[model samples]
Target: MKLLCWNIRGFGFTGRRRQLIEYLRQEEIDIVGLQETIHQDFSMHELQGLSRHQFAWQWLPSTGQSGGIFLGVREDVFSVEDMDRGEFFLSMSVTDRRVHFSWEVIFVYGPADHARSAGFLAEPKNKVERCTTPVVVAGDFNLISWASDKSSPNVDRVRMRLFNDCIADLALRHEGLGANLGADLRARKGALLDQIKVLDDLDDGQGLCPDGWLRRYALESSLMDIYKSEELFWQRRGGQNWLLKGDANTAYFQAIANGRRRKCAIPFLWDGDVLLESLEDISTHIYSFYKELFSAEPRGGVSLCADFWPLADQVSDAENADLTLPVFPEERMTAPWLRNSVKRLVRYFQLGASAATPLLQCSDRAGRPP
Candidate 1:
């Protein structure tokens, strides 16, 4: 079970969304979580169209509703607790009666606004202590990991302090897998802005992030950074989707974003100055990209895991490469990896893009730097 996450700005850029979809294809992900979903009711329902797994979104209105929350579940997982309370946290669960194995999943789009990050992040930390079931929380914490304090602009002390408080207060385990901790100037080619947080340390606390044996997974991305704007894409307001794997639920539903008229967030695509004519085109673009990537079977005969991981090359060494061809998988498959990926892409375009536009970003957000 693999979870992928990222915060792609606005969720509207359908053009670059295929990269996210293909990422899922490449990583063979299970559950996917997204943040900053900007859309209204009808516009927010884009998740249903995607193939493979069932999806749920919690699109709180930005105008009157707070924006955030999205969860996509694989078909085999058996989803339960799908709710759209117009809150920052959205929930889902999967259980195996026979094995007595169960898991509860949460995709939280915590507020980046300094004022909002506190209460939301704390409550969860406190609850995990007593919950009988194993809970995996993924998505942007909006706060730097305590390990992120190594260099550069110091993480906000108040926020950092609050996060540390949670660590002690809740005694929550760190199960993050530390996928985004690798962001650095070298990784960004001399720039100090790689959006993902690639941390070297795993949670020494409980067991939040994966470490040691889970090193290769530190690079998979569920979110796509279409706009190269360093500020927008990296630490500030870029687009991203946070995924929570483990025992995820079956397909349920949540609206990514629902706003009123005019102020509604829009994903505008343009040719220099000419605005894109249709959002429908964005969907087509994703489908085409997917076809190109997965049109054929896996190459260089290898085990499915081997095809995904260089570490797994042992499984494909010697004669195995000449044996069975590994499966890279499609997002439309009944399995967790496929359904989770495909659904995220579908909702991304619908909620992110306009009814008739392309290019992805919050063009309506005033003072948005070009």
Candidate 2:
């Protein structure tokens, strides 16, 4: 009954497709929902290759480059009864033959545009209501159910209300709602403080009941605990550096990360003497720069450094022969540890190249090698 959901953005690229396959294999997932595939068509061969012929999938192609979704069910585990596809979602009715159980699964990719998001939120209400089996709705809804769901300063109250209303209307449980209850609890505490103030102003010379004050104290304590737990959660997600010194505001941390990313981006780049702003121009400039940089020879002179530290004991002939033995293709592709290591290396290189690109461009513009 293990299910995995991811917004893969695009699965067309070879590296991403390989990574997805590796992840699926490693997690041993029974069912998977992938969003933002961006591919207009996928072949049976490609699907088999991606899933290693273990899972069967149904896909809704993207309209242009904007939206797409896919649902993959483990062929050995579930028998798919029917599939319904939409612009923003895909639903499948499946039965587990072993357990003799049935359920309806929906994978949704909500639109980013506000108006489209609203429509996406409302579109599935009827389908949800009509479903008789246990329904599992999942995917990148893109709309947060509460104000504090986003770390940015710009909290869309209207969108929050729409998202919450949609969930309530559909009678769906929001698993992450506990994280957003901090605000309501804090408001309640504030009202309690105001009531205490009014009680004090009465000057009855009789103190407030211990039970009422204890409840207020307990609420304040719970709020503080919630903040600490949230801070720890973000820290575990590798966001400690972006966290405020004393503040545990998740939204503020997100805003800081977003600001840093914006600041790091190359908005404009100099191509020879021309300043390029368009994405195409910028991409061309980067391509040309990297091509020349990698292809160019040493400017001053080439020098081969001699090995300074040599092994004290030379390898035996048997060891050298073993090293020279050819590696099999199956060994290269099927070895779990080797595949995982290569994937990690690929991810590292990709991230490093992106972060260093702007710095390298700046250095080249200043007539220096980077």
Candidate 3:
């Protein structure tokens, strides 16, 4: 079955709507999931205009002008057994008309707000765990699976880890265009190299013949295509943009990606003085450590004051006294990092908590960092 998942940006524009309908008809899309529709409602005629073939659809209204989700299935192809919606997602249980096979589909539009992202990511787990049928979850997660998934240098390692962990907990397979292209390039390279080798042996020690030379030229052209594909794949993996370079520098790009992988890897974990080298051991150690660390329940009447945060960085007593002392109206004091309330200080502690915690929990439960 064919499925199209897209962020339409908004479905309000007439031209865009017409173009989308035309494309849907041309492509014979069986299932559609659209995000950021902006509009809260659609008329029957308007819904019908999405495609000539009748469709069963479910949609969530945009919260203000910001976010929305729409899911549809061609009525002739599938029967909708059930449908549901949450603040961030639309889910449907569908049965195939031909095979009578059933599955669950969840189309999501993750929150754009970082503060709400944790709850958004956590929301699907309960639904997924309850499902007896196979599930396909797709949409714009507004997250990257890895730090290198985006071109921007400002990386949020914590968010990336949490997003990846959520995917893992859902038991979802993450695939991408670059991965498919990379696999195809490897297969093509193998075949091309074999053919080139055959041509080389055939032309061995012979005065260069036009037929052999032509065949070699064709092989060279194919090699160039492979190089271009490899370059594209590695460029994405390395998170680098290309300039007008005459040559495809696949090696350079691959090196950059490899360097990133190395920097992100933890070869071993220290458990007290002993190092955990085995995968199973490391996994157990981390799981046990964090499980114990956060297992503490809050006792009644327990609260924290500023100094109670022993591991948190502090303003010295002198600095505190200076701030508390009366100041002339003309005098001004500015602490740039501390300007934005305690948010930056709190975030700093969060990132640097490793100073106290020392070992980090692997990004994946399998004791491997991706």
Candidate 4:
């Protein structure tokens, strides 16, 4: 699953939100953790509009004017089992429906204020300590861990040490830039291309040497292998169906995915005479429609016909006892069906040891049903 953790700074700007939404769509992020949203009050519709993705969301509204944290998981990908919100964090326990893997995800916007920083850092540690499942803690930490993280020498070493300690306590590792699968795939593809270029240069120098040609063939094979891996990576990202033998690159799949998303979106719905354009209106209409459609209908009591009892067959106590009797191994071997077993057992009981001799002999032999 692709997760995006971004401090979008202020999600209040219309243009910035539009660009972020476009980026989310392009990246095909399965879960997103957004920080520093300045809005104190907002709805899921507003979030869906801002991100342009259909997802189940939970958020911690901004305190005064500065620190909102939002976490959204694509509903198709995850089933939210539980949700919680803190002063500086929003958390959710989710299960990946396809694979049935469960995890806890926390989106934090750590306090920049010295007074609140300790509590913000400790909150996640406490939350993670109790979790039995895998955990993902992400978002704007607002704490610098090293001198290189800041531009100047004004780094807070105390806060950095505490943040590092909290991470250690939770057993969480940092995933820096180019740490994800897509980045690794791209890096591998680049390395293979570089190797191929080196082989091409050697071929130019050697002219028609057999050794140079052999090296070129080996490099070309490696390049093809990397190309296949890269193609598969993009195909998964684009969520497109695999195409038959052809060199359909990343751009082709991406374009198809974009088009598919557009086609699948429900912008508006007609509620009889009224057109529901807003998300709330459309959703409410759908909910109400289904509720009414499936609502219980009033009906009279069901009655059986007087003649039905006379037509139905009834078994006597003797017949029922025979039907319910447990079949012995000798009888089961002689006859596979329950009816045959009942008749055979009855006959064996009537004829005593002489009639059961053959069945006992068969059981003593191969023990297969004869």
Best by TM-score: 3
Clashing pairs in 4: none
Candidate 1, number of clashes: 54
Runs off by more than 4 Å, candidate 3: 178-370
Q: What is the C-alpha RMSD of each candidate to the true structure, in Å?
A: 37.9, 30.5, 30.3, 28.6
Model 2 residue pairs with clashes? 151-251
Candidate 1 residue-wise lDDT, 1-370, digit = tens: 5676767555556854566676566776667776665644424345553334554444444433445555666655444543333356665666522222366776666675779778877666655654567676767666766646448765677778787677667655455543333342233332212312323233343434444324223232212122233345345321333233222342311223222433563466554565655777656665677898988875675423323324332222332222222334342244765564455456445443332122232243432211
Of the two candidates 1 and 3, the one with more favorable TM-score, higher being better, is 3
What is the C-alpha local distance difference test score of candidate 1? 0.50
Model 3, C-alpha of 339: deviation from truth (Å): 99
C-alpha lDDT of residue 22 in model 2: 89
Candidate 4 displacement at residue 12 in angstroms = 1.4
Q: Count the clashes in each prediction.
A: 54, 1, 0, 0
The TM-score that candidate 1 achieves is: 0.41
- 158-203: candidate 2 lDDT, tens digit per residue: 8888888988888776756343444544554465456556556543
Off-target runs (Cα >4 Å) in candidate 1 are: 24-27, 42-45, 56-66, 81-86, 96-100, 126-130, 147-151, 176-370
27-125: candidate 4 lDDT, tens digit per residue: 888998889988676765777575555788777778777888878898887899999887777889998664345789988888878777898887877
Which is superior by lDDT, 1 or 2? 2
* Candidate 1 positional error at 199, Å: 40
- lDDT sort, best first: 3, 4, 2, 1
